[model samples]
Target: MRLSTILRGGIVVACTAFASGTALAEDLAFTLKNATGVAVTEFYLSPSNVNNWEENLLGNDTLSAGDSIQVTVADGRATCVYDIKTVFKDGSNVDDRAINLCELGSYTVHE
Candidate 1:
C-alpha cells in the first residue's frame, strides 16, 4: 500500500509539471496593425536578448496603412519580451524593443 501511494504521488507531480511546462511553451496569437502612413514591407520579431533579428514574419505580404495582420509569437520557450522591427516600402525602418508580448493581444505601429 505504501508503494502504491508513492507511485501515485510521483505520477501526480509529473503530471503537474508537464501541464505547467505546456502552458509556458504555448504560443500566444496577436495582431499587429500598421498605423504608419506607409506600407510595411518587412516585419521581424525577435527575443529581447538576441542581437540578430529573426526572419521576416510576413512572407510575401505587405501591411499597408491601417492594415492589421495576425501573428503568432513563439520562440519554443518561456519568453515574454520581444523586439519588433518594421521596414517600410520606402526603405525606412524602425525598431521597438522590450515589448511584453505575452500581455499584449494587439500592437500598432505608427509614424
Candidate 2:
C-alpha cells in the first residue's frame, strides 16, 4: 500500500495509509494550526473516550496565529475521534475542537 500525503499550506503535514504493498502499523500525525485570532500559549490533545477526563497528551507551547504543531500516533489502531483544545498562559480559553484520526481518510496514524 503506497502511502499518500496531504499538503496543508505548503507543509507535507502527514502521510496516509499503512505502507506500500502491504498492511503495517498505522500512525497519525496530529497537526494543529493556530488559525484562531488569539495566540495560544498552551494546548492539549486527548482521546474522546476513556473516563479519566480530558487527558493532556501535549502542551506548554506558545503558538501564534498561523503557527502549527504535529504529533504522531501509533499504528494498527482503529479510527478514533479526538478532542483538542487551546489554552492561554493567563488561563484564558481559546477553543475546543474534535477530529477523527487513524481511520482511512481521517488523520493517518502509523505505528
Candidate 3:
C-alpha cells in the first residue's frame, strides 16, 4: 500500500524516509544513521541488478549528520538486495552495491 506523504517539523517526509505505523512481512525496514559528517540531501535505492536508481526518498527533506531515521523499502518486489545511493549537501554522492535489506536492521552512512 502506498502511504501518504508526511510532514513533520516543517519537513516533507516520504514513505521511504520513514516507516508507516504498520509494516508488511515482506517490507524491509531499517534505521538509517547519518555519520558522514555532512547533511544527506537525498537517498535512492533500486534492486541490486537494476541499472537505474529509484527516486529520492527524502523528498524535500535532509538527514543531518549524527541523525537517524527509520526507512522502509516497499516497492512490491520480492527482492531483498538493493543498490544504495546517497547524495550529500555538498553535491558529492556515494554508491553502494548489493545491500541485503532484509537481513540488515540498520545502515550507517559514513566517511
Taking all chains together, each candidate's TM-score versus the true structure is: 0.75, 0.50, 0.75
Residue 70 miss distance in model 1 (angstroms) = 1.2
User: Where does model 1 exceed 4 Å of error?
Assistant: 1-24
Report the C-alpha lDDT of model 3 over 1-111, residue by residue, as the tens digit. 122332221223357435765433355677888887899888887889889977888888888888888886655566778898999999999988999877878788975
Evaluate model 2: give its lDDT.
0.47
lDDT of each: 0.71, 0.47, 0.74
> Model 3 segments beyond 4 Å from truth?
1-25
Report the Cα lDDT for residue 103, model 3. Answer: 84
lDDT of 2 at 11: 21
Task: Look at candidate 1 and tell me the lDDT of residue 36.
Answer: 78
Q: What clash count does candidate 3 reach? A: 0
| Per-residue alpha-carbon lDDT of candidate 1 for residues 1-111, written as tens digits (9 for 90 to 100) | 001100000112347658777443566567788887899888888779989987887766678787776676554556778898999989999989999877877878986
Model 3, global lDDT: 0.74
- Ranking of predictions according to lDDT: 3, 1, 2
